[model samples]
Target: APDSGGGSSEDSFTEDSSTDVATEDASTLIPPPQLGLYGTLNQLQVDVSRLPRPDEYNPAMSSVEDFQTIDIPSDIKTVAYYLQAAQILPPGEDEIRFSRQEDQLAGGLVRRELDRSIARYAAESGDTATLTMTGEVLAPEVTSLEFYYFDGLAWVTQWDSEMLKGLPQAVRVVITIRPARSANRPEMIGLTNSMTAIEQGDLVYSLVVQLPLAEPPETMGDSAMEAMGL
Candidate 1:
């Protein structure tokens, strides 16, 4: 599936859009409906890998600094295999069978790739990276599972899957990032959350990852040698 370029749009997750969240004052004035117990997964693993390297180095674009992993809580039982774009039914549309063919409203629909230029650069450089997640579901009958990305302001659903057989199932999700070719060093720090629905409540798991810029190596200079008293 093609990637959604990096930019702010009406449906984009932005800082200004986050202000629309439900506030305590507003909630007190009008109590919100109970949406079951809201919980989060205990643990999640993030693996980032570099594709291949190009013959020529481009300092203008962002490179794969490193791959970092996050260990979260393991209370909720669920697993995600691959992470990518998914199609969901449009608002106001009636939900059908849990099967992908039956329920998917569209496909190749993703909020945004982590670093747009990464993929482009990787492809051009003949090197790329991928992100995948796996977990288990503890609930007896899990109705559905949804994955989202936080773009500074809000969480946007990137993949949604309906578990037809329900519960004690394994989940997998995947997404790929290539080397960035642009000079624009956009912030790669972001948060990802997953919502799993069960009979009791929803399990919401959040993980944070920051793609730092590669630090340049320091070359020996006369000032450095003097400071060291060499």
Candidate 2:
């Protein structure tokens, strides 16, 4: 659909309003929207982001702390091709997708693109040169972000429609923001645990998104059919 803008982004994944998520329940909280997710390119700021075009799932989760590159499955069995620029855009045009760091070579350009993406986010929220450490600026104030998939059973750390043979029944994401560290008390911060973040005055937001469980469309590509063992 659309991509997150450098420096101007803030965990705009689907858009959430309240920054103080500690009071919000565990349910996936919906934001009011700032960046247009679909084809709302060219605008640095939007009061609310538009929804993705039906049949288009090029998803990205850019926000305050982490900026990952876009990952669109090539031979997916479930999702209908979720990537950008080369696939989503008209031939020869480039586009940004919401994402994070590491394994950036998504859709063949994940790592490099994500580096640039995170660089943009880090420049605004944090700093790209700094690792996930205390005092190291991540995106704005966001220090870490993570995504999970629920396949009607247990929660998983990662999800690939190609491997699962269908879309996830629900998705869970955790975004951690480092509250301004105290000048008098400087400490090291690592992006490995949410509880640790909470103990250190960091704000951790958890969102569980439930998706409709629909049968795959009848129009399956040969690769998708093969992956599904059709």
Candidate 3:
């Protein structure tokens, strides 16, 4: 799939177009494409053994449990894998199943190859980085996840990606900053809560956030917050 290249359409307008035209401009008038409510949810599963601790279960929700949403670049394939597992697997077959032992082995090898590819590209591009934040929310109703970083004066924009279809209500947010090393530094980070609620189907909420490129000052981080009783 191709990225939609997200941004507000307002920037495309030219003041010259406001002039009264002699004839109806066919070029100016065009119809929008048919679109659906949700985009595909890519999934990335964490190996429990590799993880120091397992994710906690959510008691309040049943159908979906605690999950996080992370901000990652759209180009990386691993990001797609993560989105696929968390967002797509559950509904399709309850889980992602390897047909045979050989298949499983092949899948593992493929995964490693993909990881190496991502790392290589990151080294060369220096335009992306990854941050794994804990926790997950129900498939968010937001149109997109935007990564905001704190500047000295105000929160500045870092990155954003469109949410995929079947995004889990709850999924761990493992932000994968592309290029691992990048010129644009991150100062602080947070998620955006800007999403509309679906009137009919499943309730959706977004986890758009702003995160820091560098470690935040003494006032931030979990341990600091704990000390401050935040």
Best prediction by lDDT: 2
What is each predicted model's overall lDDT from 0 to 1?
Answer: 0.23, 0.33, 0.22
Instruction: Give the 10-residue window scoring lowest on summed lDDT in candidate 2.
Output: 37-46
Candidate 1 lDDT over 162-198, as tens digits, reads 2111111121221212233257543121112221011
Arrange candidates by lDDT, descending: 2, 1, 3
- List residue ranges in candidate 1 displaced over 4 A: 1-80, 83-145, 159-204, 213-230
RMSD of each: 23.2, 18.1, 20.0
What is the overall TM-score of model 1 with all chains considered together? 0.18
lDDT of 1 at 128: 23
* TM-score comparison, 1 vs 2, better candidate: 2
* Count of backbone clashes, every candidate in sequence: 39, 24, 56
For 129-206, candidate 3 gives per-residue lDDT tens digits of 111111122222222222222322233232112222211222212122112324663311111111211211212222
> C-alpha displacement of 181 in model 1, angstroms?
49
Q: CA shift at 191, candidate 2, in angstroms?
A: 3.4
Who is ahead in lDDT, 1 or 3?
A: 1
lDDT of 2 by residue, 30-144 (tens): 1112211111110011112234443334334323233232223222111111111111223643223222333322121111112223323444554322212111121334444
TM-score of 3: 0.21
Question: Which scores greater on lDDT, model 1 or model 2?
Answer: 2
Model 1, 31: alpha-carbon shift in Å? Answer: 45
